[model samples]
Target chain A: MSLTHREFWMMVHLGLGVMFLHTFFEGILWLHTGERLRRLRIGTGVMALVAWLTVVSGTWLVYPWYRAKPPAGADLADYPRAYLLANPSISQWHIFGMEWKEHVGWLSPILATAVAWTVLRYGGQLARDRRLRQVLLVLFVAAFTTAGIAGALGAFINKVAPNTFLDG
Target chain B: MAHIEIDPVTPSIIEEINSLTSSSDRPALPNGQAGAAILSAGIGSALLGFFVVLAEASTTAKQLMTLDAGVGPLSGKTTFAVAGWLIAWAVLHSRWRKQTIDFARITMIALILLGLGLLGTFPPFYMLFAQH
Candidate 1:
């Protein structure tokens, strides 16, 4: 069965959350391990790569679905209208559905690739090196925490916001 | 016959040296590495806090502007609060600073609490209590 927009978004959230949670655990494990920095680097590197993929895929999955629906009734029409009024260019682009692609689609893959590369190339050493590991651990914790918060907010919105035609 | 028994001076010299080296003169606790670790953790926690704020703001903005981006501001606030606390605690523990055994035990308990807090944001509980 085809998934509803809400289901799709929830799935995307779940995917991204799992990816982030995986990365968090990997960082913690790296910190705990007494092994060489190289080992930790590889471990974290692999986890980052997987997480990036998840994020990219989730982004792709969510955008078309998000754009297909109109804003929920609770969403202030003034915001989008004001944004359009302020940036005619955005309004023009939105006419053809190009705006969504321009704003979110174009950047998703590039960001995912960049994150993946950073983690793979420099992250291993960071994971193994004590000082670096500390930094990465902090970052991991921060990213994971932020994502979790964002997901909760999204869920709340889904629950409370009136599903206008845009929500379809 | 003029060879007098010369007592060795080595023992006396050693005793003199030992006497000069007092225990109080020894260096204090090794705080250098521990201090560095704490500093690192502090910086990390701060960065995490900043990111959490950024993420929450972005979500709020998106929800406000984007059509059908239904996430509410309250959930954003709640999620950030919970996540921020956990992240702060994690950074503090990771700093590996000197703490009493009781504090260490409490930190473990705090970690569990953090996990539960995060979990509580999920379905069922969130839907049950959070619904207006």
Candidate 2:
């Protein structure tokens, strides 16, 4: 079945949210580690920035639709827009769903993979380090891996389910 | 006796002076001075983000553009602000100072929140942006 514009845009928004959570957590883990690997830190920072932007833009796009009210000349055809504006709670649900998708979706696996890579490459040093450092490193690696997987999955979904809000 | 009256410098005193002189002569490493550079970069990025957003929100150029196609300056500015914060934290913690628990936690939480916001754009909700 063909998807409606609202459904498509919602999906994209949700996808972006998932992406943001993945990258955000990874960034935190990167920051937590005391060892400053310049390249790694830079990568994390850039990823975080991208993720942040994606979410903000996505939210901005959906906000008006969520808050849409029936224009004087509008009718049932504009229900999607009207529903969004008349009911603030719908927007909240959308926001919550987006959050859940970001935090709980594929973020865990992606982060895990990235963390594993980092550990394998720097495992020897990490192993030799203090317990606190080791723990943080493990956490970092895990978060990174999970984010990566989630990100990939999100992209796939986007390709298959392109947002079509404007078409409405 | 007069010639011998010249006070002999103590070896211990001379050794102490030599040690002090050596300690004071160490060269500074540029790489080791990463703090200033990192801080500058972080602050600079944040400032740029802030200004861009301001310009976008207030500028006539932004108004003339199609609203649906472009994000305008607000979202871009917010992204930059978040980025600036991340960079600033990295620089401060990595180079200038230690990462305080509160500071680190706050930044991480903020990132997570932003991520959650991003997720709100997914399927079902993706229609919010689709052109009519």
Candidate 3:
């Protein structure tokens, strides 16, 4: 299968996303178990960085291509947004799925950064502060949920209208 | 990452740790730092949702928010939200840095804001405000 630049970055974004989620889950487990505090701090920091990169790249690089306007009277095949919208049967993918994915997906990085900061600030000490740990856990889970929603919708949209360049 | 071995904390261990915390060279820092970050995150997320709804509802707003032609209004929405979050965090941190803040209340408020942000960004919910 020929892979375009857009497709390549999309895959990188996906891989990083999966990696972030895994790291995020491990953080939750560490907090839940109340062990490995230092590890959680460092892991969370890296995860937060990955989360930020994913969101920024998704928004700046991938999204622009996905939403690129096709020239007048041109085939919409290269324009994922236009392609999705050109047909009523699948327009919902862009309006509903893409809309939600683009906006809500942003929450993950913001919240993850907060979580990372908290962990780094109060590493092993979190084990003593149940309330702090609980609060972080809740926010952490919320971040995960947002990323999961965005990722799922992104996968569906990509399946229906894969965002890729015509030339490999 | 280098591993720093820590004994697994049980309930009894937590109590013991708490007791030793003050005597130890490093005392537990104020919860204010965490609170500021958490609360500001909520603020950012909620504002982002609000921006989504606003941009959808108003053409002028959409145009104003379209910081980059390539990325559309999204660039503005995220930029504004992130700026707001950082500002809020800085302000909150300065005030609460030295003192212990009420985390329970902060958490509740943050959660509510987060929920609003989530609801606001939901396609169905925000689309209701769409002009076209």
DockQ, all candidates in order: 0.02, 0.04, 0.44
**CAPRI-style quality class for the chain A–B interface of candidate 1:** incorrect
**The best candidate in terms of TM-score:** 3
Write out the backbone clash pairs for model 1: A37-A128, A41-A124, A69-A166, A70-A166, A71-B67, A71-B68, A157-B70, A157-B71, A157-B72
Q: Give all candidates' CA lDDT scores.
A: 0.40, 0.41, 0.86
State the lDDT of candidate 3 residue by residue for B1-132, as single tens digits.
999877776755676455345434587688888889899999998998889889989999999999999999999999988998899999998998887888889988998999989998898998899896
Worst 10 residues of 1 chain B by lDDT: B28-37
Docking quality (DockQ) of candidate 3:
0.44
TM-score of each: 0.35, 0.34, 0.89
The order of the candidates by lDDT, greatest first, is 3, 2, 1
Q: Model 3: how far is A156 from its true place, Å? A: 0.6
On TM-score, the stronger of 1 and 3 is 3
Better of 1 and 2 by lDDT: 2
- State the weakest 10-residue window (summed lDDT) of model 2 chain B: B28-37
Pitting candidate 1 against candidate 3, the one with the higher DockQ is 3
In angstroms, the error of model 1 at B115 is 25
lDDT (Cα, tens digit) per residue for candidate 1, span B41-113: 3333333233333433465543543332332232233234435444654565455434423433433443343
* Window of ten residues with lowest summed lDDT in model 2 chain A: A105-114
Question: Order the candidates by DockQ, highest first — what do you get?
Answer: 3, 2, 1
